[model samples]
Target: MVTALMELKSLRKAYGETLVELGSENKNIVVLDADVSSSTQTKMFAQKFPNRFFNSGIAEQDMITTAAGLASQGKIPFVSTFAMFATGRTYDQIRNSICYSKFNVKIVATHGGVTVGEDGASHQALEDIALMRNLPNMTVIVPADYNECRQAIKYAVENERPMYIRIPRINLPDIFDNSYKFTLTAKVVEKGDDISIISNGDTLIESIKAGQMLKQKGISAQIIHCPVVKPIDKNILKLISNCKNKMLFTVENHSIVGGLGSAISELITDEGLGLKLVRIGVNDQFGQSGTAEELLDYYGISAIKISEKVIYEMKTTIL
Candidate 1:
């Protein structure tokens, strides 16, 4: 059954609020922002915990390195910045300084994917997931909505390792409740006999709607939300993969190349699942300035387009 109606929420707020709560509980917790605290919502933590919040002032590399230093001192640092700056800008620092040493740091990268909208390509961190996950010690998470985002913050605080959490600039719907907990696996939101619509991040809202649309056309679509993108539950992949009839579709607000799509594709191919797969996301292209809704549709990653792709595939290939 549908868990909740699409309730729009500023995920950035959740990021900040959750940090404040965690900050109060754990004195070892410190926040670092690369001067985009307001946009990324680290400002909330800054307001609550003035002494603990450090603004790195537009220096992502310096910020990450500082976080590394803090981690080495037994401080669990939660770094916040735009996704592009957090990953693409500070990769060397993260790899050499943080991931290399397995620092206890959590990088909360907001404005990930095309959701940055009017900011265009340079601001959109489409390849962040692939980049972060490739690191040996990084735990990558892409929360689907508000509840997941809050829980992910909690998860990051409880765990001790180099972690990356990707959130959005836009307000997304609520997928889970206060009771929902995140694990390193996929959550099967809906079950079906035909196909699985595996997706993560804010794009999951569209996938759920797409599932309903597919049902109207007599498609029994299974909906799966992946909170933990890396360290994917291989058993879940095995459960839904390798079926000729139950093809797989990966939906993400990221590049079809190295993001979720590529991860699953590699899994299916390497394991010899031999299942038909289609990726719905940015088609190896840069983002353009526009509203989030417009960009999503233009890139053919919207709910309507996702369902259409499945319909077309079922007609031309499945049959």
Candidate 2:
């Protein structure tokens, strides 16, 4: 079931608000940061409740371990840091310490994807969804907008399993209205029969735009903003499978290997459905130093790039 309709806000403000709201409800809720409190916007929480906040000083591995320890003692811990360092740098700790043990730790990773911009490839985490979702007990979520991110963070805090919440650094258009509801697994943003554009993360804005473009070209492109990438939304996949046209596209800000595209691919293949699918995302390559828009165009993940590819496939492929 989807949660309450929340108003859209800035990305950093979203994190700060989530921290504050969660703090008010559960005294056991603690927040840990790896010296980037300002970036994660958890420094405000630190100011409000210093006793429950810990700045681990750039040690992501140690922060993960600490969060796991706290969870073991029945505390809900939200670990904050850049996605690259939080997931990439502390994979073992997250995998073994938190997930392997089935500890309920909410790993909130900020600065996800090329949105990290001038931070370059080293700072941009293009493979975080792949990394987090591959874990056995991890609940991976990629919220579409600021409002969705806030609702997802609230939902993650209440969820029992180990979870990872991804949020980009830069804010985009507010897709959801102030009273828009959010569901955990799958939410159909729009419906169509010609083709399905299943997307998540920052690229979702472009996917919405692409859908409009397809509409003008007399092609109906349905949009599904699937925030939860893991634990496949089988029902939606079944609908896509049974559709007569059976053309599908999975778009994301990450690599095509094990992200949203791969998830959708697995969903169709597992159901023995022969769907014509195109995975639109960063191929198996690290991002370079460029603006978010430049990197997207470079990696062929922009709205125009994705629409062009989809149009080409539709025209040339004998599906």
**Residues 1-319 of candidate 1: C-alpha lDDT, one tens digit per residue:** 2467667888788888999888898999999998888888888889999999999998999999999999999999999888888999889999999999999999999999897999899998888998997899889999988888999899999999999999988898777877887788887887777888899998888998899899999998888887787877676675585334757899999988888888888887888866888998998888989999999899888999999998998888853
Q: What is the lDDT of residue 85 in candidate 2?
A: 94
TM-score of each: 0.97, 0.94
Clash counts per candidate, in order, are 0, 0
Q: Which candidate comes out best when scored by TM-score? A: 1
Candidate 2 Cα misplacement greater than 4 A, ranges: 1-9, 241-243
Model 1: lDDT equals: 0.87
What TM-score should be assigned to candidate 1? Answer: 0.97
Distance from true location, Cα of 37 in model 2, Å:
0.9
- In order, candidate lDDTs are 0.87, 0.84
